[model samples]
Target: MTAQILDGKTLAQRLKGQLQTWLAEVSPQVGRPPGLAVIWVGDNPASAAYVGQKQKSCAQVGITSFGGQFPAHTSQGELAHLIQQFNQDERVDGILVQLPLPADLDSTKLLHTITPDKDVDGLHLVNLGKLLRGEPGLQSCTPAGVMRLLGHYQIPLAGKQAVVVGRSILVGKPLGLLLLASDATVTFAHSRTPDLAGLTRQADILISAVGRQGLITPQMVKPGAVVVDVGINRTPAGLVGDVDFVGVQAVASYLTPVPGGVGAMTVAQLLLNTVQSYGQRHELVMPQFSG
Candidate 1:
């Protein structure tokens, strides 16, 4: 069977429209628009592209954007100080430090400096702890986005076997927890996991978050299983995901495209998190979206 596309781009646009309407109604009462601060360092091309997309999305959703790009040589102390400033800024509802900071900088320390409430990226220890406890908190964008997309599509997860192919804190580990919370039996496989294809073929829901191109071949996928490709690999041909798209499209029941799938949802969820934080701060009731 030819797999149906998950079509995250359309869903993301719909979500943004919803946010715009909500902000229009609430901004007047709150006395100011929800504000998001993005602290970007260095000249990483990918990071620059992501930051631009985030700022553009913020404008669309009526969220004020703050913070600016810093040079590669910017020190850890300076970044920590800036995070503290945003934490104390009443106008700022969310603070995010673009990842892949200079190698010399301590990313964990800088991330921790942002207060838990304003940590929209949801990488702070406090937020992670909340996730570990299955409590309400800002969630890491990509994994949250994946769950949102699946929920929007009405994909079943309860009592199903789900395999997550990655181990990084950003996506794989947290995503495993989310799947578990939905009552799916979860398995995490990494580069060292022997017979990766065997593990993947048994999954009712297969997710590949490792950044390796063409990692999840059609042979590795179980027929009728749902596949979510979260990898973002930049090649000369353009952006691609971990799965072999053309091949897997014929084998799997559903699939998420690279550029338009998880990527679009991630930005949408970041905006959603910022709005949620804003609503909480103002004692406003935020409407819940599916998943």
Candidate 2:
């Protein structure tokens, strides 16, 4: 069977529309739009593209975008100072430092500098700890986006077998926790696994977060399983995902497309997180989204 596309692009757009409506109604009362500060270091092309999309999304959703374009040589202390300033800025509700910082920077220390209340990226130790305990808190964007996509389509998670390929703190681990919370039995497969194909073929829901392209072949997937591809790799052939999309689409019951799938949802979730932070800080009623 030809798999149904998961259509993250359409769902993300719908979510953004909902956020915009919520912000329009409340910003006048709050005396300012919800503000999000994005700290981007260096000139990494991919990071630049990611930051651009995020800021653009913020504009669409009425979150003020602050912080931009730090040079590669910018000192760690200088960046941390900015985070401190953002933490204290009453207008700002969310702050995020773009990843893969320059060689000399200490990303962990700098990330820790942002106040948990404004840590909209949800990478702070406090937020991660909250997620670990299955409590309500800010969530990591990509994983949250994946769950959102699945929920949008009304996919069943309870009592299913889910296999996530990758073990990164950012996507894989958080996603596995979310799946388990939904009562799906979760397994994490990584490069070190001796039988990746055997592990993957057991999944009712399969996800690939590894950056390597074509890591999950059609043969590795169980027929009729749901597939979510979280990897974004730039190759000479253009951007691609970890799954062999064309091949896997023919085998799986559902599949997410590379450019329009998880990537779009990630940006949408970032905006959602920013708005959630703003709503909490202001003690204002906030509309909630699934995922």
User: Where does model 1 exceed 4 Å of error?
Assistant: none
Compared with the true structure, what per-residue lDDT tens digits does model 1 show for residues 1-291? Answer: 999999899999999999998899989988999999999999999999999999999999899999989999999888999999999999999999999998999999999999999989999999999999999999999999999999998999999999999999999999999999999999999989999999999999999999999999999999999999999999999999999999999999999998899999999999999999998999998887543
Best by lDDT: 1
Of the candidates shown, which would achieve the greatest TM-score relative to the real structure?
1
lDDT on C-alpha atoms for all candidate structures: 0.95, 0.92
Backbone clashes in model 2, listed as residue pairs:
none
TM-score of each: 0.99, 0.98
Model 2 residue 131 CA deviation (Å) reads 0.5
What does candidate 2 score on TM? Answer: 0.98
Per-residue lDDT over 132-220 for candidate 2, one digit per residue giving the tens place of the 0 to 100 score? 99999999999999999998899999999999999998999999999999999999999899899999999999999999988999999
